[model samples]
Target: MNITDLKIKAAQIRIDLMTMITAAQAGHTGGSLSNTDILTALYYRVMKHNPTNSKDENRDRFIASKGHSVESLWCILADLGYFPKEELTTFSQFGTRLIGHPNNKVSGIEMNTGALGHGLAISVGMALAGKRGGKTYKVYCLMGDGEQTEGSIWEAAMAGAHYKLGNLIGIIDLNGLQISGKTSDVLSSEPLDEKWRAFGWHVIEIDGNDIEQLISTFDMIDHKSDKPTLILAKTTKGKGVSFAENQISWHHIVPTVEQLNLATIELRQQIEALRKEEN
Candidate 1:
């Protein structure tokens, strides 16, 4: 899809996320909203995968390490025809396949993630397997800034660089906010880019919500070899919705009916504006 079209699709995903969360009455609303654009860019543009055969060995992989944002992933997967869109309404309810975190039991999900710091290790294994089998598939992992505090992340980072897993890309959703408070206030990872570089991974920083920058960065990753890529994507915690943007309180808060209505309206306006630009 063209960048403009992708932007519109991202807006739609934001709309779906808000609606699904409101209906479920429980979800990680802030993280889902913050990560929507990056997820949209990956599914619709960056990743190479067969929606018809999600298990295809040669297909690219995506592990959402920030698994609380599973609502956004589920909405995108449904939109991509991975499952029936109706199933999204059952999210967080009893007997629903769309759990708050991803489970590999689902047709399109690659890993069961939510615990943070686990994705990089899994991604390293995937990359190593691809290399051993002489397969050309790539592995991508999306992690939150808060998750960086886990020592496991650095351990996996060392492993990936040691193995020279150039086919692996780790994108950090550096929104600078975690559940308790601002990430810096909690645990300062001041020199984030330098830290990744020291680990021997190629680092790129970009505005996570900017579609053009995301596309360009992904393209750069596609061209890089012999070193893993790390994209430090600076983003707003609760993006798109006015009441939620940059507010840590909405991290797990269920939006009130009025708030949901206003959010939907705001998203619709953004979508319409993008559509007009396209026309």
Candidate 2:
């Protein structure tokens, strides 16, 4: 898909995310909204995978280390037909596999995530496995800035570099906020570029919410380097929704009916604008 197509698709994904969260009556709304564009561009335009053949060994693997935002992943996976769209309404309900966080049972989910610091560690293992097995598949891990404070993340970073896992790509959703407060106030992960570079990973920073920037950045992945890649995707906490943008309160609130209506209208306007541009 073209950049314009991915932009439109991302807008619709936000709409679906809102609907899913509103229906569930609870979710990590801010993080989910913040990460939507990254997920959309990957699933729709970058990743090499087939929903019908999800278990294909040669396919790329995507792991959401910051799994609180599984709502975005769920919406994308369902839309891609990895699972039925009807199952989305069951999110957060009892006995539903589509709970607040991802589980391996979910059709397209590569691993069960939600223990904030575990995802990157797991991705390192998968990437190493690919290396050992002589597989051509790449492994991508989505992490949050807040999750960076975890010692395990740095440990995995060192491991990836040690192994020279060039096929492993780590993308951090640098949304500037986490659940408690601003990430800087909570735990500063500053000097990010130098930190990752020193750990032996190639780093690139860009606006995560810009579909065109995302497409081009993905194309710039360098597999020839002996180092892994890290993308610092600077993004807004709650993107797309007007009132929710960068608002900490929306981090986990179920939007009131009025708020949902307002968000829906705002997102609809954006979608329409994109549609007109397409025409």
Candidate 3:
């Protein structure tokens, strides 16, 4: 998809996730909205994936380390036909594979994530295995800034560089806020770029919400380098909705009926604007 199309797709995804969350009456609203464009850029434009052949060996892999903000992923997977889009209504319901977190039982999910910092570790293992097996597949892991506080993430960072797993791409959603409050206030993971560089990974920073920037940055990743790459994606929590954007309470709060309606209108307008730009 072109830049305009990607932007439109992202807006629709934001609308879809918000509706799903409101219907389910639960979700990580702020973080999911913040990272919607990042996920859209990957799944729709950058990543090599197939919904019909979910287990294709050579396909690129994506691991959502910040698993709590999985609403955008679930919507994307369903839109891509990994499962029937109708099943989205069952999200977070009893006995549904589409629970609050990413479940490996789901067709496109790589691992059962949500345990905070384990994603990069597992991604390093996948990238290393892919290299050893002589496969060209790449592994991409999306993490939240709040998740950076996990010690395991740093350990995995070291392992990734030591292994020279260039095929491993780790993206941090630097939305600046977490469930409690501002990420800076909760745990200062500042100097994130310098820290990753010191850890021996190539670091790139960009506006995570900008689809064009996301596509360009992702395209620049070197899959055969001796060092892994880390994308410090600065984003805004609750992006795309005026009332919710950057509000900490929305980090995990389900939107009320009125809020959902307003959000839908805002996103739909964005979609329409993007479509016009496409022309």
Candidate 4:
């Protein structure tokens, strides 16, 4: 897909996120919004998966390490026809499969995750499994900047590099803000890019919201041969919603009806503009 088309799809995902969270009345809106573009770039353009057979053995894998942002994954999975979009309304409610965190019970969900720093390790195992089976499928994991504080992340990093699991690609959602405050103030992961490189992984940084850059970066990663790839995607905490943008407090807050309407309008406007550009 072209950059403009990707942008439009991202806007639609953002809109779907807003609408789903609003209807469900509970979710991690901020993180969900922040990571929409990255997820869109993966599910729509980068990852190789068959929605009709979500568990296909040779399909690419995606692990949501920052699983609190499952709403974005849920919305995109629904868009990809993993489940009915109408099921999103049951999110976080009693007896709902669409919980705030991802559950593999849902089709197309590769891992059940919510705890921080677990995804990379799981992805390493998946990549190792693929290699053992002589499969060409790749494994991708998206982790939050805050989640890096967990020591297990670095351990998994070292293991991935040691194993030379070049089929594994880890993308960090560097939105800066976490639930409590700025990630730097909460726990500094300064020199993040250098840290990954020192661990023997190939690292690249990009504006997470830019679909073109994201697509290009994914293509670049696909051509890499030896080391595991890590993309440090700098993003706004509550992207595309004016009121929630960069606000840490919005991390798990459900949008008020007024706020939801405003977000929906902004996303629609963005989508319209992208469509105009295409025309």
List clash counts for every candidate, in order. 0, 0, 0, 0
User: What is the TM-score of each predicted model, taking all chains together?
Assistant: 0.98, 0.98, 0.99, 0.97
Kindly report which residue stretches of model 2 are placed more than 4 angstroms away from their true locations once superposed. Answer: none
Task: Write model 2 residue lDDT over 1-279, tens digit each, in one string.
Answer: 887778878888888889988988989999999999999989998899999999999999999999989999999999999999999999999999998888998778899998988998899999999989989998999999999999999999999999999889999999999888999999899988899999999999999999889989988888766899999999998899978899988889888788888888998899889889889
Worst 10 residues of 4 by lDDT: 218-227
Tens-digit per-residue lDDT, 128-202, candidate 4: 899878999999999999998999999999999998888999999999998889999998988999999999999
Per-residue lDDT of 1-279 in model 3, one digit per residue for the tens? 888888888889998999999999988999999999999999998999999999999999999999999999999999999999999999999999999999999999999899999999999999999999999999999999999999999999999999999999999999999888888999998899999999999999999999899999999888889999999999999999999988989899898999899999999998888778778
Which regions in candidate 4 have their CA more than 4 angstroms from the true location?
222-224
The residue ranges of model 1 lying beyond 4 angstroms of the native Cα positions read 222-224
Name the better of 1 and 4 by lDDT.
1
TM-score of 4: 0.97
Give the Å error, residue 120, model 4: 0.4
Residues 1-279, model 1: lDDT tens digits: 999998889889988988998998999999998998899999999888987999999999999988988888999999999989888889889998889999888888998999989999999999989987898888999999999989999999999999999999999999988999999999987689999999999999999999889998998775348899999999998899888999989889998889989999999999889988888
Model 4 steric clash total: 0
